[model samples]
Each structure stands twice: as structure tokens, then as C-alpha cells.
Target chain A: MVTETDIEKLALLARVALSEQEKEKLRTDVEAILEYVSDIRKVSGGEERAVPSLVNVMREDGTPHEGGVHTETLLSLAPKREGQYVRVKKIL
Target chain B: MSINLSELTIATARRHLANGDFTAVELAQSYLAEIEKKNKNLNAYREVFDDVLEQAKGADKKLPNFRTSKLPNLCGIPIALKDVIMLAGKRAGACSKILEGYVSPYDATAVSKLKVAGAIFLGRTNMDEFAMGSSTENYAYGVTKNPFDESRVAGGSSGGSAAAVAGNMSLAALGSDTGGSVRQPASLCGVVGLKPTYGSVSRFGLMAMSSSLDVIGPFTKTVEDAELLFDAIKGKDPMDSTSVEVSSSKLQVKSLRIGIPTMIRETEGIDPDVRKNFEDCLKQFRDAGHTVKEIELPTMHYALPVYYVIMPAEVSTNLARFDGVKYGLHVSGKNLLEDYVQTRGTGFGMEARRRILLGTYVLSSGYYDAYYAQAVRVRAKIEQELRDVFAGVDCIATPTSPTPAFKIGEKADDPLQMYLADIFTVVANIAGIPAISIPSGTAMREGKQLPLGLQLMAAHGREDVLFEAGKEFEKLRDNRGGV
Candidate 1:
């Protein structure tokens, strides 16, 4: 069973803040979902089968690339923009 | 003759435009009028494009030289796109606040292809936030009501696209199906929805939900229109390396063996009306001289549980991109870490947050092997079982959804119950196979008729079989005078 502490740790790891009420609700919801999916442990056994279609896809290292047409468009979408760059909070 | 937009299919509309019977601008205007009348109650389209007539006017000029100019099949067709798809310079938010005011930088490969085909996009439709929930209720904007019955949900996360096509606001619409996002809503809204085989269509522009399971498909009023849209959009794309080129052969209905999962019907939660409709569909298949056999798929019971584990894990990882600095909702906090917390916590809806938390819990240190790894192994088992079953049968049939469209707040409180709404449709995604949900009949509920869909699953890369079966099933339904 997941406790409030576990929920808190998960919220921290997930980088999402939860209120006391939301955290308590998540604790119950997550616990119920985990208990339900625990059936996977009972059914899954032996060696894992290889999924054939999941092959490593690679592109040539030195292909000429077209410049993105939407640099201005993308920059305009940023919440806080300064000229051509997106502005963010100071870190250090 | 004045055209009734409500009766227009992509196929019929194309012929009318080709023959100069109507201009694309007129066609678009008809749909715009319909959207104006119905969008208030249905909540299908998030934004109707202001330049729809301008785009249609371009198509009208191009329609005259089609034969010599090598115009595409979808030329001059007006269509709707689910909000999750990116169209350069347009807002593609997946119905979430985090992505509010965010404009796409480039066209999704599918969108680019549709544009190249001279298809006029009418607008972007609403959907569940990040395509996370079974109903469109998870939307930060508003829930899309079923066009047939306003009180019930249009099955989601492509609910808006389904509603748009069902309400005749657009000829056809593009929808991305991750765990039945396309098919369930299509079923609920009484339209045709196809989820092509994994990697069949490029996902370069679609907002990632569960990357492994997300396949962009179409919602149309007819199977033939779905085929046209699928053909126009499907191909290998360099931007999406997972896409592969697969050749298809014609499917012969006379020689087809349709497998019915007897065990699935015996499973709980299926409504009696849905079962009867399914049985009626089978009887129609039999009357049409096709064989239906009961097949046991024991792993079917475990699909929902496996999906819940695997999908949320992928969702958690995929959604990490919305950190708020670059393109979406950005909130300032004391520090960088707190910035992410506040932005996401405030931006995401309850369903999205719950899934993110569940995903984080499963992928966390101690529980990775217990939940995530185990779920993968079982997923492989399910895939293998489906492969073995396909060797013996041409296609497998099941109810697209357990019941008709449920009331809006019916399953809202219980997340688990809401997840169960996709129970019958997720198996195709998990196994990387093609599935189509076509309207079989309608069931009566609360003095109103709600649509029920029959789902058909085919082997990987065999969407041809699905289309063939779907076309035949549609014919049988029409013969019986059933919508």
C-alpha cells in the first residue's frame, strides 16, 4: 500500500506539487490502481520475448538539414521571451 | 441542386467538387453554418478556422485541372483535425491549459500530407487533456457531448473529432488512437473510426500520449472515406523512424474466418443491450455467408490491467516535455524545480495528474520490476497469443465498447471505472495490430437511441482485411435497415 509519504516522494520525483487534499486522494487512487495491476505479476513468467519490430533506427551523421521555418513562431509562443531567446527564472 | 452538408461524405463531396457541381468554398460554408448551429451544445470544435473559405477557394481553382495535374484522392475535401495534431502556426493544445496559446512550429507529417492532397482543414476539435482520459471530460476546455444525445459523452480522447464527423460539421477528421481513443468515440458517436497498425501512420506531429501505442487514424461517416483518409496520410516518414512501409492485398470476404472471443463476452461489465447488438451483428455475418467461431483468448482479461500500467508509464515520460519555459504555461517559483511543480500542478487536470502520479509510482525505484517490467512481459505474452490466433483466423471481432455512451458524470468520480470504458478496444493497440470500429446498430437507453459499435481486429499490417470486413459489415447492416 502507498502511504502519504510515498505520495509525497512521488510528487517530488514527478516535479508536481500536490495539496494535502489532492495528495490524500492520490494515495487512495494510486494504491487501488497498483493493487489492480498486481495481476501482471501472477501472469508474467519466464524469459522476456523479443519484440522484432523495435529495431534501432539511425540516420546518417552528416546529412544537410533545412533550417526550421518556425524559429520566430516558436519563440513567440514562449511565456517570457527576450528578443530571440526564451527567458526563464534565475537558477544560480 | 443545393447540397446538404449533413448528407455529404468525403467520397460524395469529392465527386461533386470534381464535376463542378459545387465549389469547395460553398462546401466549407455549409459546414461552417452547421458548426455555428451545433458547436454551442456539442462542444466539438475548439476553434473554427477563419480562413476556411480562403483555403477552399484555392482548392476550387485546383479542382478543375485534377485529371492532368495528378491531384491526390483527398483533393478539395474539407476535414476536421483533433486538437492533438500539429498544424504549423495553429494552436494544437490537446485540450490542455499547459499548451494554451502554444502554436505548432511545423505541420505534423499527416497534416502536411493532407495539405498536399488539397484537403481543407475546417478546424481543430477538442479532446481529453494530453489525450489521457477515455471520455473527453478530462479536457481543460470543456467536455464534448455526444451529438446524438447531449447528456451522454462522446467517447474520447478523440471525442471531439468523432462528434464533428457525426454532427456533419466536417466530412472526415483525423484522430490519434492510444488505447481506443479513436475507435471508442467513433463507436459511441455512430461513425467509422480506424486505428491502423502501430507504425502504419507517422506520429511525428501528434502529441505523445503512450508513444508505443499511439497511432493516428481517421473518423469518417463511411468505411470508404476512412480508407481514403488513411491512404492519403499513411506512408514512411523520415521524421518518424518507427513508420514502416507495408504492402496490402485484397481481402476476400467469402474465404474469411471471423473469430469471436466467447470468453470476452462471458466477462463481466458488458451491457445486455450491447451483447444483443453484438449477437445481432454475428447473425448478420452468418447470414452473409461468413463463418463465425468462438475463440478463447484468456489473456484478454489482463489487457486493461496491462494497459493501465504501460500507458501511464509512457505518459509520465512523454509529458515531461511540458516544463513551461519554452512554449507552454510557465509559472515562476522560488527555484527551477519548484517552477516545474507549480506549472504542472496548476496546468494539468485531475485525471492527468493522477496518471502522472501512478506512472511515477510504478517506475519508481522499488516497484519498477514489480509493475512496469512484469507488465511488459505480459504484454509480450498477449502479443504472442494474438499472433497465434491470427494464424487461424482472418480477423477477430468484439464489441467496440462494453456499453453505449454513458451519462456525462456517470464514471467521472471513479478513475478505474473510466479506464474500463476502453476495455474492449485496447487489446489491438497492445498487440500492435489494426482495428476498426464500425457502427453495428443502436441500443435504447433512457428513451433515447445510442449507437453501438462492433470492433474487428486484423493481423499486423493487414488494415486491408479490416476495411474489407468493415465494408461488408456495413453492407449487411444497411440490408437489415440498421444504422
Candidate 2:
């Protein structure tokens, strides 16, 4: 069973703040969902398999000139921006 | 006389445009008028693009010369897009508060192809927040009601797109499916929806939900429209590495063998009306001189549970990009970390939060092997079983959903109950194969006829089989005077 403390820790890990009420609700919902999905435990002894015919596609390490078409547009979507850079809180 | 927008299909509209019966502008106006009449009540479209007529004008210029000039298939057809699919300069929030003000900087690969095809964008459609819920109730915007019955849900995460097509607001719509988001809603709304092979369609510019499981597909009134949209949108793209070349082969309906999963049909929670409809569909196939046999997919029972584990884990990771810094909703807090917590807590809907938390739990250090790893192993087993079944059968058949559209708020509070809506549809995504849902017939619920769908799944890269069988199924139904 997922306890309130465990739910809180998960919230912290997921970077989502939950109120006391929401956390309590999530605790129950999470427990119920986990219980339902615990059926996966019944299946045992299968080797890890990757999708067949899939290959690692590699591309050259340089940006194409056509890719720059969206640069200014992407920068404009930033909520907080300075000049051409996206602004964020100082990590230091 | 003005064209009837309700009965207008891509093929018929194209022919009319070619004959100059009505201009593209006239067709666009007819749909816009219909949307105006029903959109407020049905809540199918999140926003109707202001430049719809302008786009129609562009298409009109090419329509007259279509015969002489090389014209793409979807020329002048008005289409709707699920909000999760990015269209350049359009608001695509995925119906989530977190992306409330985000405008896509570029078109998704599929959208770009649609533009090249001269298809006009009607607007972005509503969806479950980040495509998380089986019903559109989780949307930050208003819930999209079913066109057939206003009080019931339209099935969801792609609910709004399905509703738009079914309600005559758009001829067709594009929707993303991660665990039946497209097919389930299409079933409930009584339309055709297809989820192509996992990597057949490019995922570039689509908001990631479950990266591996996610696919962009179409919802239309007929299988041919679905195929047209699929052909226009599908292909390997330089933008999406996972995209691959898909080859097509002609499949004869008479020679094909369809597999029916006896185990899944006997599973508990299937509604009697749905079972009846499914059995009737199989009878039609058998009567058409096609062989229908019972095939056992032993690992299918674990598909839903495996999907829950795998999807949420990817969801937690994919959605981590929505911090309050670069784009979308940003809330100030005491510190950087707190800012993320506050922004996400306030912005994400309840279902998104629950899934994220569950994902975090499953991927945690101590539980990773027991939950996530175990789920992966079982997923492989399910895929292998499906591949083995496909070797013998041309396609597999099932009900798109266990039941018809439920009343709004029926399973809102209960997550498990809602998850059951995708039970029959998720195996296609789990096995990374192509699947389509077509309206088989209707079932009476509460004295109203609710639409039920027959789901047909084909082997990876064998969408031709689905389209061939689906068209034949429709013909059989039409011959019987059923829609």
C-alpha cells in the first residue's frame, strides 16, 4: 500500500506540489491503480526483447540551415525571455 | 442549393469541387456554420481558426486546375486536429492548463504534409489533458459531448476530434493514440479511426505522451477517408528518427482469414450488446466466404497492466519538460524547484498528476525491477504472441471498447473503471501494430442507440489489410441497411 509519506515523496520527485486534500486522494487512487496493475507479477521468466527491425539511426552532428526557420518563433514562445535567450531562475 | 455539410465526405466534396458545384469557400462556410450551431453545445472544437476561409481561398485557387495540375488527394478538404498535435502559430495546449498559452513554433510533420495536400485547417479540437484520460472529462477545457447523444461522453482523449468529424464540423480529423486515445473515441462517436504501425507515422512536433507507444492517426466517416489521410500523413521523415518506410500490398477480402480472440471475447466486463454486435460482425465476414477462426492470445490478459506500467513511466519522463521556465504556464515560487512544483501542481489536471506520481513510484530505485522491468518482459511476451497469431491470420478482430459511450461522470472518480474503456484497444499499441475501429452497428442504451465499433488489428506495416477488410465490412453493413 502507498502511504501518505510515499505519495509526498513521489510528488516531490515529480515536482508537483499537492495539497493535503489532493495528496490524500492520490494516496488512495495510487494504491488502487497499483493493486490493479500488480497482475503483471503473474508473468514470469521472459527475456527482455527489443522491437525487431529497429536500427539506431544516426545523423550528422551539425544543424541544418532550414532548421533555423523556427528558432525565433520558438524563442518567442518562452514565457520569460531576455533578448534572444530564455530567462530562468538562477541555479547558483 | 448549398451542399449538406453533414453528409459531405472528403471524396464527395472533392468531386463536387472538381465539377464546380460549389466553391471551396462555400464548403468551408457550410462547415463553419455547422460548427457555430453545434460547437457551443458539443464543445468539440477548442478554437475555430479565424483564417479558415482564407485557407479555403488558397485551396480554391488550386481546385480549378486540379485535373491538369498535379493535385494532392486532400485538396480543399477542411480537417480538424487534436490539440496535442502542433500546428505552427496555433494554440495547441493538449487541453491542459500547463500549456495554456503555448503556440507551436512549427507544424508537425503530419500537419506539414496536410498543408502540402491543400487541406484546410478548421481548428484545434479538445482532448483529455495531455491525452491521459479515456473520457474527455479530464480536459481543462469543457468536456466534448457525443454528437449522437449530448449527455454522454464522446470517448476520449481524442474525443473532440472524433466529435468534430461525427458532428459534421470537419470532414476528418487527426488524433494521437497512446493506448487507444484515437480508436476508442472514434468507436464511441461512430466514426472510423486508425492507429498506424508505431513508427510508420512521424511523431515530430506532436506533444509526447508515451514516446514509444504514441502514434498520430486519423478519424473519418469512412475507411477510404482514413486511408487518404493516412497516405497523406504517413512516411519516414528526417525530423523523427523512429519513422520508417512502410510498404503496401493488395489484400483480397475473400482469401483473407480473420482471427477472433476467444479468450478476450470471454473476458469479464464485456457488455452483452457489444458481444452481440461483435458476433454479428464475424457472421457477416463468414457469410462473405472469408474464414473466421478462434485464435488464442494468452498474453493479452496482461496487456492492460503492462500498458499502465509502461505508459505512465514514459508519461512522467515526457511531461517533465513542462517546467515553468521556457514555455507555457509559469508560477513564481520561493526557489527554482518550488517554482516547478507550484506550476505543475496548479497547471496539471488531477489525472495527469496521478499518472505522474504512479510513474515516479514505478521507476523508483527499489521498485524498478519488480514493476517496470517485469512489465517490460510481459510486454515482449504479448508482442510475440500477437506476431505469432498474425502469421496465420490476415487480421484480428475485437470490439473497439467493452461498452458504448457512458454517461458523463460515470467513471470520472474511479480511475480503474475508466481504464477499462481502453481494454480492447490497447493491445494494438502494446504490440506496436496497426489497428482501426469502424462502426459496426448501434446498441440501445437507455432507449437511445449508441454506436459500437468493430476493431480490426493488422500486422505491423499491413494497414492495407485493415483498409481492405474495413471497406468490405462497411459494404456488408450497408447491404444489410445498417450504418
Candidate 3:
């Protein structure tokens, strides 16, 4: 079962904030979800044998440039942005 | 002049449009009327463009002068697009309420190419929310019904595109295939569907489902139409890094070696009628002077688990953009975090939520190496297996779906059962190869005629072979006078 601590960590890792109520609810929801995936854990060594396609597909070595969706488009959707970068809530 | 342009093939419509037999406006109206008449029964369209007539007027004026002898293939053709593909100023919601009322400001690269080629856009078709389901029943707008029988599903998440073509609401439509989304529906609806090789078509403005597997192709009544549309839309697009330059070739039969994977035939839960139809397809090919062989690609057995794990992990990452703060549906909360939690919780439907949660869980730090990493490794193995098999065979054939279209809601609750719908189709996606589904025959279940699809897969950049094989099959079917 997911605990309050687990919810807090997950939310933090995902870069989203959560409240006490959400934490409580997600604890239960996430716990039930984990129960659903428990079958995967039970399958004999399925975790060790899996693989994905697109192996070693490396990006071309060139000047790092952001392509598609200009800064105007990106800034258009941001809650706030300093000249060019997204402005997030102050943590300090 | 009163002809339904949607009912005209890409070639026929061009002929009529050039001869001044009918104006584009009249052609557009005929299709609008047909859509009006059939949409309530088929659910093939989500939103019909209000300015289609205006666009058609513009197209009529822009018809190029190549001496008027023969016109461009797609000129004045009304084509429907799956809801996932963006058409500027049109809503491309992918059948989800979360994106309701969202209009694309820019057209997708393929849509833009089609527009340049003088193809008339009918409107956006319906699809499973986020292109997630096999049956279009998961669509938020409503389920798309089979044109043959309203009680059955049209197959999904390209159901609307397939249904529009099959029901004669449109002659050809663009649909994206991720796992069997495009092919399954085309088979069920008894139309031709093509999924080109990965990087064959640009994915520049499509909403992401599983990025690696998604490819935009066409659903049409004929192989010629599929080729015409695919040729026009496919090429290198700078916007998509994966886009490749593919040279179109004609199907040649010096000596074609066709592989029928016995492993898929022996897969659990294959319906008897589908098996018989698949066997008949093998026999037909043999009789047609092509060499047919049974090949073993045992790695195909693990496609589902690998796909499920890898796709959700990708889903977890891709769906992070829909947190309600930036441009989608938002539910107010006291703070930013509360707002995000509530918005995602309520805006996403049951299936979406399940996938997101599962994806999130699998991609979590500690579990990433175990689930996500391992799945990627296995994916490479599967790709190699495909390469090994293709070394001996010109193409592989299988039943598109183990069974024909089932009733809506039959497999909705069973995710595993719903997943099996893609068993025959996913290996192509996993291997990043080109595949097509052509209607082989029809099966009778409970006094109803249901369509069955035969799948043909070719090596990367080998689409001509598929079209050649499909052409012979199409000719044979035509001579049989339609099942």
C-alpha cells in the first residue's frame, strides 16, 4: 500500500505539488494501482528479460540548437517567463 | 454535378474535376450531404469543417494547367483525417474531452502537403481517446459503428477514418497506425489501410501516443488510392528528425518468398473463421504463382508484454504535457499543485488514467531499470528477429486481428483481452517495418456479415511489394463480385 511519504516523494519527483487531501486520495489510488500491477512482479523474471527497439540511435553531433516551436510559441503558453526562460515558483 | 466527391476515388474525382463535369463546391456539398445522412449511424466524423465549400472554391480556382489532359491524382478529392492529425483552424482532439475546443493554429506537415497537392479536406474523423483503444468505442464523442452493421465497432483508433472510406462518406482518409490502430479498422470496415515504414511519413503536428510506433498512412478502397496519397505525403520533413527519403518502386515478382508465421496462427484465442480465411489467403497466393513459405519468428510471442511496458513508459513521459496548466482543460484548486492534481484526475478518463498511473509507476526511479530498461533491450532483440526473418522472405502475412470486429463494450473491461487485438499488428510497429491490411473475405457470425483483414508486412522501405501483392488480391476480390 502507498503511504503518505510515498505520495510526497512521487509528486516531488514528477515536479508537481500536492495537498494533504490529494496525498490521502493518491495514497489509496496509487496503492490500488500497484495492486493491479502486482501480477507483473509475480511473473517469473519478466523484469530481467525485457528489451526495446531503437538501440544506440544517437543524435547527430552538431551545434546544439532548439528546433521547431520557437520561443514565441513556448512563451505563449507559459504561466510566466523571464525574457526567454520559463519562470517557475521560487523555491528558496 | 451533384456527385458526392467523397464517393469518388482519387483518380476518378480528378478526372471529373478537370473536365468541368462538376465544380468543387458541388462536390463538397454532395459529401457534406452524405456525411449528414450516414454520420448518425456510422459516427465517422466528429466535426465537419464549416468552410469546406470555401476551401473547395479556392481549390477549383487553383487547378493547375497541365493542358487539362490528365489532372493531379488528389486534386479536388475530399479526404477525412483521423482526429489525432492537426488541420489548422480545425479541432484535432483525438476523441478526448481534455482537448475539447482546442483548435490547431498550424497544420501538420502531412496536412500541409495534402493541401498543397490540392486535396480537399472534409474534416477531422473520430478516434479512441489518445489513440489508445482497438475499438473506436473508447472515443469520447461516441463509438464509430461498422458500415456493414451498426451494432458492431468500426475498429479503432482510426475507426472514423476507415468507416468514412468504407461507408462512402469519403473515398480516402488519413489515419495513424500505432500498433494496429489503422489496419485493424480498415480490415473490419473492409478497406485498404497502409502503415508505412517508421520515418516514411513526417509526424510533425500529430498528438503523440507512442512516438516510435505512430505513422500516418491512408485508408482507401483501392491500392492505387493508397499509393497516390502515400506518395504525395511521404518524404523528408526537416521538422521530424526521423523522416527519411523513400524511393517509390513498383511491385516486381521475379521470385517473391512470402512467409506465414505459424506462431501467430497457433496463438491462443484465434477465432476459427479468421484462421480459415488466413489459410485461404495462403492458398490463393500459391495459386497466383508466388512462392509461399512458413517461417518461424519466435520472438513475436513476447511482443505484447514488451509493447505494454515500453508504450506506457513512453506514455508516462509524453502525457506529462497535459497537466492542465498549459492550454488544456483545467480544474481550479487552491494552489498550483492542487490544481494540477485535480485537473489531471478529472480531465483524463478511466483508460487514460490507468495508463498514466501504470506508466508513472513503471518509470519511477527504482523500477525504471527493471521494467522500462529491460523492455527496451527486448525490443532490440525483436527487431533483430524481424531482420533475420526478412533475410529469407520477401514479405510476411498474418491475420490482422485474431477475430473480426466484436460488439462494443465486450472487451472494454478486460485490458488484456483488448490488448490481444493488436497481437498480429504490433510486431511490425515493434520492428519499425511497413505493413498493410487488405480485406481478405467476410465471416458470418450470428447472421451478420463481418469483414476479416489479411495483414502483409514488408521490410523497411519496401512498400512497393505490398502494393503489388495487394493489387493482385484486389483484382481477385473484384472478380468475385464483392463478399
Which scores better on lDDT, 1 or 3? 1
lDDT of 3 by residue, A29-57 (tens): 55654554343333333345544333544
Candidate 2 TM-score, C-alpha based: 0.98
Candidate DockQ values, in order, are 0.74, 0.78, 0.18
Worst lDDT run of 10 residues, candidate 1 chain A, spans A44-53
Model 2: residues >4 Å from true position, as ranges? A48-53, A66-69, B69-71
RMSD of each: 1.5, 1.4, 4.4
Ten-residue segment with the worst summed lDDT in candidate 1 chain B? B67-76
User: How much is B240 displaced in model 3, in angstroms?
Assistant: 0.7
**i-RMSD per candidate, Å:** 1.4, 1.4, 5.2
Chain B TM-scores per candidate, in order, are 0.98, 0.98, 0.96
For model 2, the docking class works out as: medium
Better of 2 and 3 by lDDT: 2
Better of 2 and 3 by DockQ: 2
TM-scores for the candidates:
0.97, 0.98, 0.87
Sort order, TM-score high to low:
2, 1, 3
lDDT of 3 by residue, B1-483 (tens): 567543577777777877888877788788888899999888899878888898888888876552263544466778999989989767777787677557676789999999878889998898888888888886357889998888889998899999999988887899998888989999999998999999899999989988887899999887878888888899988788878889767666665789988796568899999999888887777876778988988667767777777777677678788766555566666767666767666666656665665577678888886666666766777777789988989899999998998998888766667887898998888888999999999999878889999999999999998888787777766676754
lDDT for each residue of candidate 2 in A1-92, tens digit (9 for 90 to 100): 88999998999999999999999999999999999999999886576544445678899899577766777888888888998789888878
Candidate that beats the other on TM-score, 1 or 3, i.e. the better one: 1
Tens digit per residue, CA lDDT, model 2, B145-230: 99989899999999999999999999999999999999999999999999999989999989999998999999999998899889
